[model samples]
Target chain A: MDREEIRVAVLRIEGTNCEEETATSFRNLGVEAEIVHLKQFYSDMIRFEDQRSIFDYHCIVFPGGFSAGDYVRAGAIFSARVKSVLRKDLEEFIKYNYPILGICNGFQILAELGALPGFDEDRPISDRPEMALAINDSGRFECRQTLLRVESRKCVFTKEIEKDKLQIPVAHAEGKVVFPRGREEEYLEKLKENEQLVFRYVDDKGNYSGYPWNPNGSFYNIAGICNVTHTVLGLMPHPERVTFDYRKNSFGDGYYIFKSVISYLEKI
Target chain B: MITFLFCEKLIVFMIADVHIELKEGVADPEGESTLKALRLLGYKRVKKVSSVRVFRIEIDTKSKEEAEKEIKEICERLLANPVIHRYRINWIG
Candidate 1:
């Protein structure tokens, strides 16, 4: 499909504040991107014209923000609502190998929905979440620029970025990625072996550091990851926030992420 | 009519209190901060502190066992994240 033919859906609901920037990122790339409400896809209360089908879009972007107020764990409420209503559509979306990107709170939602570390191939969505994005070790909301080392090129979202490290802004109180206790080592090994590990938080010197350098103190300093299919990706950083051109020196390292998605869709 | 409504309320409403906390190994920053504050206030004997989320859930069930079962499912599926936290359910009749 042509780049223009790529219909990207930047999904949002109440409290999801990043949809506009996410959609604009795709629009800047000359693709048709729309900020779609979760209600539009599932709620019957919406008008016929407003209601939409998930299958209508080629790519779905779950943008950042505290959806449904991030109560009862950051993304649990939103994830449960999605599962209750649109689980089949999401499963089918994953089955067909379309790209799904989740940033920050979106990352938490994907994990809550069992879409990350998607261990079971026959079942893309796990019956229960195997991992979680827990509260920051700092005990407060952290908002700052973070250095991320690109650990893998296997994902459809990060394939175009040739750089070893990129500076992206991370804003969240619950961005610490943790697997279930006792299974951490085994799961980490499996993720490494599968090449599903996407990005790791690092310091300016490119070393895996602790505390503020690692921000929320994510497990293994992991900043992002993908599923076995390499299509569904969940990361804590806000790539959309940096896609603008004003930062000439860094040249918006995140722009390549959207470009990679566009390139991947074009080939399909 | 008032007695009937009161009796009906007694049979219909059941409240379960759930307390959820991060597992022993998982880091608890809020708990740690509370400990720090206590230390600063000269509470030297207080060795540690932990934080927990208390959820009071009202479920419609006739028997206590059914209420417990339903609340347990609710905690497992929504209130608690099994990956990082463990939860206990208490029947508050």
Candidate 2:
């Protein structure tokens, strides 16, 4: 696979605001990236010529933003719509080891879709969600800069990240990742043992911290994770927003996310 | 309005009251915020606050069992997230 042959789809719906930047991030890396509407994949109203399939692209990105106005819980509406319509396709996508990236609300959507913490390769997408992004313990939206330490080499998205820690921005109300009630420790242990935990929130000193440092109070200071197969990934920070700095003429920490996935697709 | 006209009288269909809430031990930020507001308003004795989102759905179904199945699917697939939420459904017509 060549870099020119890699195709990325930045999945979007109403109220999803980060598709443009996300698509630009991929395109900046010299790959064919398109911001595609979810409806175009399954809506009957869509014209035949414009209709598309998940197989059309090598990677699908669920970008950030308040999808479906964050009603009935953030990302619930979007995830439900996706699961109801594209469940089998997405499951197959995961099983095939095609990269799937979700940022912020996209992270919530993937979690809601039961595509994260994919502990079983034979069953990548569970019938019920294995984890969720709940409202911040602060009881309000948290938007700030966060430091994340790469915790897993197993994830495809962070393998090329040159730094051990990345300074990225996080903005969301429901960013606290939680497992089923009372079983958080068990799942955290499993995630650790499997090397699926991709990014852990760190403080200024580069150590796992709490509160504003952790941003959403995510358990185990986790900021991002990948499935067991390392095909599907989700994180709370907006990697697209900080990919490059024009004046500095240098890549930001988030650049490695898009770069890593594209390299993986190209190499494979 | 058209349903009433079709029935000639407002004969009601089955109604479902679905309560969706975070599972026990999960934090409820909205409920906590509400509790904080109440405390500010001088409600001193409030020990705890819990929140539930209740939805009333009306469906035209022939049997209680059938309605139960459909509503359960609706709750599981949309109204509630099984990972962090547990839902209960009550039927009335």
lDDT of 2 at A228: 89
The clash number for model 1 is 0
Worst 10 residues of 2 chain B by lDDT: B1-10
Model 1, position A51: C-alpha lDDT score? 91
Tens digits of lDDT, candidate 1, A95-160: 999999999999999999999988776788987899999989999999999999999998999989
List, residue by residue over B3-93, the lDDT tens digit for candidate 2: 3434454433678899998888888988999999999999999978889999999887555788789989988887888878999997655
Output the lDDT of residue A226, model 2. 93
Cα misplacement distance, residue A17 of candidate 1 (Å): 0.7
> Which ten-residue region of model 1 chain A has the weakest summed lDDT?
A242-251
For model 1 the local lDDT of residue A265 reads 94
lDDT for B68 (candidate 2): 89
* Candidate 1 residue spans exceeding 4 A from truth: A247-250, B1-12
Name every residue pair that clashes in candidate 2.
Answer: none
